[model samples]
Target: MQSALLVNGTLISDESVRQEDILIRNNRIISTGNNLSGQPGETNIIDAGRKYIIPGGIDPHVHFALPTPEGCSCDDFHSGSLAAMAGGTTFIMDFVTPAPGQNLIEALSLRRQEAESCLLPYRLHVGLTWYDHTITSQMQQCVNEEGITSFKVYLAYKGSIGIEYHELEKVMHAAASLNAIVLVHCEEGDLILKKQREFVAAGKTSPLYHALSRPPETEASAVKKVIDLCRKTGCRTYIVHTSAAKSLQYIRAAKAEGLPLYCETCPQYLLLDESVYRKPLPASLKYVISPPIRGREDREALWVALRDGTVDVVATDHCPFNTFGQKDKGADNFTLIPNGAGGVEHRLALLYTYGVLTKKISLQQFVALTSVNAARIFGLFPDKGSLRPGSTADVVLLDPDYTSVISADNGLQQCDSDIYEGMPISGKFSVVTAESV
Candidate 1:
């Protein structure tokens, strides 16, 4: 086992920052406090020297090597994990969407095998698109035997991956029975399909129309539906990649009533807006993500949500596709373009610059949004998201003074276009250490 000591660093916890030294052995932090000592030959000493030592970020939502009809996302486990680590994210919770007629356990087994080469430790949230006795039983097996505590459901993508209303209620009941958390993609599928038809018929099929087709109401309506179901069934529910400010009202009301409901928004939702859809032809397609970026008002609302605790975490929702082959497939029709963006390699630095440096949120709030909250919600708390003693030694050294501009050439994801290109950013990761895989 390799043992090491990190000296003279300010540790960012959920509450505050404190100067401390951390001692690591066998890939775990054995102790953390002032004046920690280590034997010379037994432990290597790393002088952190005024850097911020924060727990490695855990992105609760990420899709790596996702298979779509167009093609697999450009970033697989290997490249995605590398990008995540480069950005100081130590663990990610990805999904396992089983194929038609495929057993849930088998799908998880195969996905785990496929992800054997991933550099960082990872966990899976099984997607339950359809429900039956067998599938319901499998859900229990996943929680009990596979150690997966979170399940995902889609309210959009109708006919394909979306869950029917009645079936979703039953699934929620089942999840509640097992004390499992349900994560949902909240958007009314039928409403989006109808709007798409209207847009295409009017010869308005540009990339900008992608945003027009799914208006804020589409997401807000679905968010309300999930909240109602969670309230009825008593299941802990989390909404993913929430992009609309209208949806925040529902989340806020639910939280006020003490419902076990939580929601996460991504970096693009906070910083980017719908204008990206109107950029150039091929360049604009990169921002055609689902639940597309909203107006400037919504962007400001997300920042407020982060500050006031309406938004529990900030994740990447990182599903990267190349511009050449993947995005060009939908040149004539925006609907064909795969929806996602690459941000795993830039999440930490971007948030630090915009969220912390700009005074929108405090450093402690940043730590909670980036790491601690997700850990507690997703059952990886002390082990993965805290710098406390006996926690897995997943640590990041953040240099607050570093400054740079964003570009694809310096990123680790297997992608051609950088959505945040030319964006000025301060603060970079000096070093990152992940627990043994």
Candidate 2:
């Protein structure tokens, strides 16, 4: 591969920043400095126009080609990874749902094949998405093959993907034995379903009931329940899409107890509100995620968690769904509405614009949530998410002063609509390079 010089930008890595020229040999980041000062030569210069050249973001929880309540996720490997790149993300860990009675290794291999032939030119990592007995054996395959180092178990969704109490315990115990981390979607499905039925039966079928159905208590209870099981099983656990501040407090206390627990929050929880669900038409359904968005109090609480270091990472959970027929499918029955919004094209920008500009989190912490922490947790550090000397040259150039209006059209997500449409953002990804770039 030809050598190239990435010059004149604020090089932001896992650690500090420097105005340096990064040398790329093949796909590896060979050197970094001004003028390659006192180092090797023979490289073509690619000026960065003095943008912020940071490590490529690593989004740990994204469900592409994911099957859900409404339908399979709107974004597939090709479209999802394109949005990931357009948003300055270079690597993503997508879940591979193992077929019943299929080998975990084979399932992962199939996922890899899809990714290799995928149209999107970005790095893809696989994780085992488990529902039943597939957890134990597939986890062993993830461990043995190292194709996947993490697994997701739903604590709250007892109806569909939700695991029963014993199944939850068994999965946690299995994960504990395999040294794999279990990430849970922590909204109690039983309580949520009961509330849904009651609300609908009473003729209260508005979108507001979506939140009412899965109240914060639903999430908190499921968190405590899952954490208790994790404690008993001695497993490493992470709460995915943590919304309520009270739930975060529980995890904070567990961390105080030295529990092997970690948690992640999303942009919607920080930037939007439950009121989004009340918006007319497409707008309301756009924010219809599980463990529903909370009130201002919970939103502020999440900011505090991100500030005081109670939270570990801030991933987009970049699971894109349609705002038209897809999300609106369940408008008549909120349960049928798919529970996610598109943000792979906006995760980093949203965090940078909202997190740092608003002073809710520091730039260093932004780098941590968007990069370092994810790479650390997902086991793809130096190679996929870092800017170290030996790491891949994958990077994103951010022009902090540049402003842009975010619309459904500009976004790279395969979905038809964007939840954050028309929102003005200051920072933008001006350029991006992947390992194979």
Candidate 3:
């Protein structure tokens, strides 16, 4: 059996941080406590002095090898997973978006084949792009046979991937019956499409107009609608990449009423704002993400939500498109720009510097947001999120004193441009260990 011991490290969990030594046998953690000992020549001992040993991060959202009108996303599963591991993330949950008329199980199998090159353990949340009487049975098959427990439905890309509220209600009902959670991209598609037409007509087709078209009201309205549906159906629902403050009020009220509504905000939503769209040409185009980055007030609201537990997880909507070929394809028009940015390789360092060091959130809260909460919410729990005995031996050793600036040239992601370029960050990973399952 493969065995290793990690000693003299401060172990961080969702509830607390304390010095503990962890013993691993094969892929499982054998124990975690003070002064753990292993027989000489039988086990390898590794020192983790002055480091914070925490559960490996689980990014609950990412798009690898995603096919769009322009082309496939720059980073495939292998490259994206490499970037994830470089940033101390051990497990990632990506979506399996089915094509029109594609069977959910078949789509999942195909996505699994594409993800075979991924370096770390991963799971998929199947997308319900189109609805029919057969969907309910397919969802059950996915849960029982495929180990997929989450369903993603978009309310943004209308006529393509997005479904109407009535369709969403059906999906919610089906998912609720199966005890599965629904992940929603909460943007009013009709409103966005109307605005897009207006912008293009007036010749306001810049990236700035992209943000202007999808105002906070659109997201807020969709959030409100989704909350109402959750109350009606009693289905657990999660809002993905919640970008506006107005949206949180509805989520907070839903949760207050004990509704099974969860919210996720990305680093871009919390740290970057609408100002990026105001920058020059191609520079502005990269920030043209869906439910575009909101204003400073929304940014501040997200930070407050993170501190107060309104936000459940901080995942990177890590879809990357190169500026030269992908993003700039729509240089004369904003809608054609593939909406995504890369941050999987910098989520930990950026959050550690801005979130933990700045006191916006505590170390325990940091652990929860980055790894623990995601694990618990997504049903990975002790196996992937905790350092408890019998858990998967996936750990990250963080050097608190280490500091560096983020640049695309040094990043592991295949993309040529980074949204967080030139951002200075504190703390770096000293060692990241993930025992393959």
Candidate 4:
């Protein structure tokens, strides 16, 4: 790779933003400082014009090109990572579901091959599952060879991704031994299925009923189980796409008891609510995430947790289902909706627009949520989430003073829809640096 100097931008990695020049030799950042003038020989020069620079974001929980039985999510690795780069994210951890009768390693190989075909810019993290003990070592290969060190286990979805609490114990024990992080999608599957049936039987088939069927009680109960299991195994656990405010209590209690437990919430949970779907025909199917987007009260609570120390990180559970083929599958009832939203393109902007600019969080905290803490937790620290020496030249130059009327017209994702359509953002990324931008 040709070397480059990303000079004179406000470099904001971790909590600090400095007007510095960054030097990239090969793929790693070699040096950084203020008003850096590049030596013209051999080094490619990039002038930032003094815009804010951030560690290109690291989205630890996104599902790309994942075809659910119901409908297709909008963005593929190419389109999704393009939108990610356009929005200032440099790396993503996407899940790889094991194919029918295939083991975790086989699934990972297929996903890795698919990702390579796109010649994508962002570094992608491979996600493994502990559905079968036979593949635990194979999942470890993702970390050992592929640099994919994280795994996910769902507490919802019945026999599918949901491993029983005992299986969760097995996952925790194994991950602890492997030194990998375990992410949990915590909602009681049996409860959701029972409640879904009850809603259908009781004629509560509206989109809003989706939220009602998978109640907060379901999340709290299952999360408690997952937390306890992690505690027993001495494994570090992350609560993924945490939606229910009460569930944070379980995480908090685990933390208080000195368990290495962490939690991540989404912008949808912090911004939108179930009430949005309460339209007569239920436009709310648009926000049907697994632990569904909650109410205004829950939103405030999540914000409070973020502002406080209870929450560890903020990630867009960027599972995008296009409004037509994906989301429309649930047109008859909310339960059939594929569980995700298109937001890798919108995460940093949303946080910057609402979280920092609005004073819900400090710009420092915004950096932590979007890049710093996520990097540390996922073992990509310094290399992927910083402007320091030996890090990827991946960076996002931002115009905080600029404003845009956000819409799908400018969207880079292949998906036809976005849930946050029509919102305005104060900042937009003007330049990106990688092997290629």
Best by TM-score: 3
Tens digits of per-residue lDDT for model 2, 254-341: 9899988888998888888787767776567777777687899999999999877778888877776877768877777776777777
Most lDDT-accurate candidate = 3
Tens-place lDDT per residue, model 3, 213-323, is 999999999999999999999999999999899999888888889999888989999888898999999899889898899999999999999988899999999998999
**Clash count, predicted structure 3:** 0
RMSD of 1: 1.9
Task: Spell out the clash pairs found in candidate 3.
Answer: none
TM-score-best of 1 and 4: 1
**Position 426, candidate 2: lDDT:** 79
**How well does candidate 3 score on lDDT at residue 348?**
87
> Which 10 successive residues of model 3 have the least lDDT summed?
428-437
3 versus 4: better lDDT goes to:
3
Residue 310 local lDDT, model 3: 91
Q: Put down candidate 4 lDDT per residue, 338-382, tens digits, no spaces.
A: 877778888888999999888998877888898888888887787
Q: How do the residues 278-303 of candidate 1 rate in per-residue lDDT, one tens digit apiece?
A: 89898898888998999999999999
**Consecutive 10-residue window with the lowest summed lDDT within model 4:** 119-128
TM-score, every prediction = 0.97, 0.91, 0.98, 0.92
Model 2 residue pairs with clashes? 156-187, 156-189, 157-162
User: What local distance difference test score does each model get?
Assistant: 0.88, 0.76, 0.90, 0.76
Higher-lDDT candidate among 1 and 2?
A: 1
